[model samples]
Target: MKIGVVTFPGTLDDRDAARAVRLAGGEAVSLWHADTNLHKVDAVVLPGGFSYGDYLRCGAIAAQAPVMESIIKAAKGGLPVLGICNGFQVLVESHLLPGGLIRNEHQHFICRDQKLIVESNTTAWTNQFSLNEEITIPLKNGEGGYIATDETLKRLEGEGLITFRYKEVNPNGSMNDIAGLRNERGNVVGLMPHPEHAVEPGFGPDTKIAMRSGVDGLKFFTSVINSLVNA
Candidate 1:
């Protein structure tokens, strides 16, 4: 499978995302934000970054990019799309996902290894995870707090669209401690954590077994590959 990792002007983690794809035995295709073509990739990922310098609003400008126009259409047709960190902001801005992200409750940029519980394992990006399983992923963001209307929150919970939730503590004050969410079709997923940063055994978050041994994020890329192969 080929996964396209999009790079906006100020994107910081496109390479990391691409590396994760390659490590998962998939071809990593580089995608530019302005390019309308997706190069026939099987899946697309919007990596973390401060696109357009986060001007106007985080991801607001990038959401209007030509590439997003194509992605939005493709995603609606069931193409799998995963958005991480600032990419999550773009997904919400593009209306590909519900809710909004705002500045952290304490109004400061935060970076840490965040523990998340797998709330749903049915999405294309999360099928490898077990329900209620706990995993740690790197998280760094300024505007990472998630907010949603009451009705939308109810629907998300009732429909099992909530994919991941903060395990022990809410780092960003998101409503209901939602760490991630999936679309109704389960192909589109957006989360604030940087799973790409946790794919390698020696470079990821520290684990009880050994220093920097956690590689739980590798399952995300592998899960998508499996989903495509089995589809």
Candidate 2:
């Protein structure tokens, strides 16, 4: 499958995301923010970083980029879309996902390898994870706290759309420890953690084996490939 990684000015991890796509056995296509075309990629990944320098609000500017117009349409048409960190912020700003991300309740940038429980396997990106299965990934952000109104929060929890939940520790003051979410159709996903950084075997976050932590994040990309194959 060909996966497109969109890069806007200030997007720091676009190349890493593209590399992860390649390691997952998919062709990585680089898409630009100024371009209106997606180059007919099978799926899309919005990588992490401060687009537009997080000016005015995190992801606010990038949400309106020319490329996002195409992504929004493609996602709604059942093409899978995964957004990480600032990408998550863009998804929210573009209304592809619910809730908003704000400054960490502590008002500080937090960076760590965080444990997250996969709460839903119904999404296109998370089919490899059993419900409630725990996996750790790198989490780094200044504005990563997820928030929503009581009604929205209740609805999301009740509908089982919450994809990932913080475990062991809530790195940010995210309501219900929501580390990620999927749209109602499950094709579009938004996550705050940095999964791309965790896809390499030896270079990922410290784990069980010295210089050899397995890449759990690869499952997300492989799941999409499997889904496409099975479908």
Best by lDDT: 1
Clashing pairs in 1: none
**Regions of candidate 1 where Cα sits further than 4 Å from its true position:** 210-212
Show pairs that collide, candidate 2: none
Q: For residue 53, what is the lDDT in candidate 1?
A: 96
TM-score of each: 0.98, 0.97
- Whole-model lDDT per candidate: 0.95, 0.91
Give lDDT tens digits, candidate 2, residues 66-85.
99999999998999999999
Which regions of candidate 2 fall more than 4 Å away from where they truly are? 209-212
Measured by C-alpha RMSD in angstroms, how accurate is candidate 2?
1.4
RMSD of each: 1.2, 1.4
Q: Please write out the lDDT profile of model 1 over residues 1-231, one tens digit for every residue.
A: 989999999999999999999999999999999899999999999999999999999999999999999999999999999999999999999999999999999999999999999999999999999999888999999999999999999999999999999988899999999999999999999999999999988789876666437788999999999999999
